[model samples]
Target: MARWQPKLGLVQETLLLTLHARALDAKLPSPILGDTLSAELAGAIDYDFGRLKVKPSLVATTALRARKLDDVVRAFVAVHPECVVLDLGCGLDPRMFRCDPPPNVGWYDIDFPEVVKLRSEHLPSRSHLIGADLTESGLLDDIPGDRPAVIIAEGLLPFMPGDSFRRMTRELAGHFPSGELALNGYTRFAAWAMKYHPTIKALGIKAAQGFDDPREPESWGAGLELVEEQFLTRAPEVALFPQPLRALTRLTARSTGLSRQGARILRYRF
Candidate 1:
């Protein structure tokens, strides 16, 4: 059998990094996300994950952040079983499967045409996959606006320019009557560090935008109100880390300023 080789652009190819991170976590005895599907999908591909040199901390952080997002989605769907879920720039991640929203929920995974094609071929999903550039107009027209919606932008925001990001948030907010928007946020300092980080540099990906304040998005006219900001370092999952890493995370968790420098999951109600 031939290994699947990914033909993706630099930005799109960065999905492999998160995939690798999840795969690594799946191997742990007490995994944070326990996404063995990521490991299976990763193994089927021919790409060389060795070159990324994905560290343990990276894997733990990725899984922890994903789990945090999953918790938010699960909680939302529990209350609004008939909601609509739009996973913007979803890439190949099987978030719908992880969240397992009720049968009444409508799940849509949106991404570039090429990536959507790849997802259709590799990942098993019940989601309605839409192939389109998120930055373009009329992309949101296909999504139903009658129900409450949950818009999740996992790794999509940083790649978007500031103006585009603002416009997207506002458009999405306006599309739904009321719902939650969850995303992994990067502070300006974290964005800078991402550029120089060995793994990120290897992928030739740089974050196009970052924010110092979680509440800044509210000013974008999205009618978005900051609900909560979850710092991964402070999450209970950190206890699953190795001894040294766990201690370091606990120490950093003590300071809001220091924890903000790492990964954060931000939730907003619109």
Candidate 2:
């Protein structure tokens, strides 16, 4: 197979990281992210992201985060059957199929125009796909505000600067009268380190901003409240990790400082 060089949009570029991580996860004796679609996508693209060297711990972290986001979307839709679910920066993730929103539930997967074009050719037509840059406001206008809403940004926050993140929050919160927002949170140091991380650097991606405290999002609006902060390493799923790695996570989970140093699935209500 010829090596396929990806000319993906920013959202698509970032989302493909999960697919790569999923591929790495498959190599594990025990795995976290088992999205067969992700594997298929990688194969279809003939992706050759040479020797990124992802640590099992990192792969486990990715899997755990994806799983939790899946759970949050599921729970949110369950309560509000008529809710509008907007997946911001949704690049080729089969979350709609996984969550299976009811017919009444409106699902919109928004990313760059080109990514949406490619996604239209590959992904099943269930939810509506919008091609727009999320950094700009007004795109949310197309989504209905009458129903309860759920906004999810899986692995996107760290890529934006603090001001931009705040603007995004304000725009999203302003769009829906009441809704749930969920994302993977990163510490300031982790955000800075991500830019220099061998894997991220090799992918030609840069870290724009990060917050040390999860509560920082609250400042975006008084309506936003911190509902939960999920520590993936301590989840029951960690027990499913491969040998040696499972034991290592156990130790990391026991230490409060060490666990917070890792990725977080942050849930908020507005």
Candidate 3:
């Protein structure tokens, strides 16, 4: 079988970097994510994984965020066993596989048509797959609104421009009668720094959208209320980090202001 040489947008290309990061994390002796599927998918893709320059810090944070998001979804599913899930801007993460929702739950992985096509080629069909541009107004029409949704936007927000992210949130909130939104929050400074990140730079991303205050999204008329702000720097998983990286994370964890610029998972109930 021929390897998949994906043709994706500049923003979509970032998925490859995250996918490679998870793949690398899986290779570790005591992997954080242990997403072996990512490792297998990375091997099947026809791309230069070396160019990603995925660092240990990147691997740690990426896996940690995914783990945190998965935890939220699992908890949500436990309560709302019949809930629907919207994995917006899902890329090729295969998070549905990691979450493993029961048969009654509806899991929809939303992404660009090409990215969805790529995922279909590699992963099995376990849930609903909606392949389209996220900006489409009626994209969620086929998704029933009666059931609660567990929306996970893992590595999504930054790529959305200006009010697009906010707009998307509003749409989702209105689309689903009730649900929770979980994502890796980025402060304005962190979003700006993302452009200079080697992996982001190589992917040619310019600027990204972010909020200094996690509660700011509540005012977007999305009906979303801040439930929790999990700072990964202070998370117990930091113990898994190697010497200097673990030490650095501990130092940053000392200050909430500093930790906000690091890895953060924001949970909002709508």
lDDT of each: 0.88, 0.79, 0.90
Cα TM-score of candidate 2: 0.91
- TM per candidate comes to 0.97, 0.91, 0.98
Candidate 1 lDDT, 1-270, residue by residue in tens: 347999999888878999999999998899999998888889899998988878889999989888888888888998899999888888888888888887899999998899999999999869999998877778877788999998889988878865887888888888889999999998988877788888888888766568889999889899999999988888878889988999999999999999988889999999
Count of backbone clashes, every candidate in sequence? 0, 0, 0
Q: Is candidate 1 or candidate 2 better by TM-score?
A: 1
- What RMSD, rounded to one decimal, does every model reach? 1.2, 2.3, 1.0
Give per-residue CA lDDT, model 2, range 1-270, as digits (tens). Answer: 333556875435766777677766755666676777766666777555565656666678887888889899889888999999988878778788878888999999988787888678877789999998777777876788788888898777877654877888888788778999998888778778887877777667775567777788888764789999888778999888876988988888898677776777889999
Error of 1 at 2 (Å): 5.6
Clashing pairs in 1: none
Minimal lDDT window, size 10, model 3: 132-141
Compose the digit string of candidate 3's lDDT tens values, residues 125-148. 787888878766778878989999
* Ranking, TM-score, top scorer first: 3, 1, 2
Which TM-score value belongs to model 3?
Answer: 0.98
Lowest summed lDDT window (length 10), candidate 1 = 203-212
Question: Highest TM-score: which candidate?
Answer: 3
Candidate 1 vs. true structure, TM-score: 0.97
Off by over 4 Å in 1: none
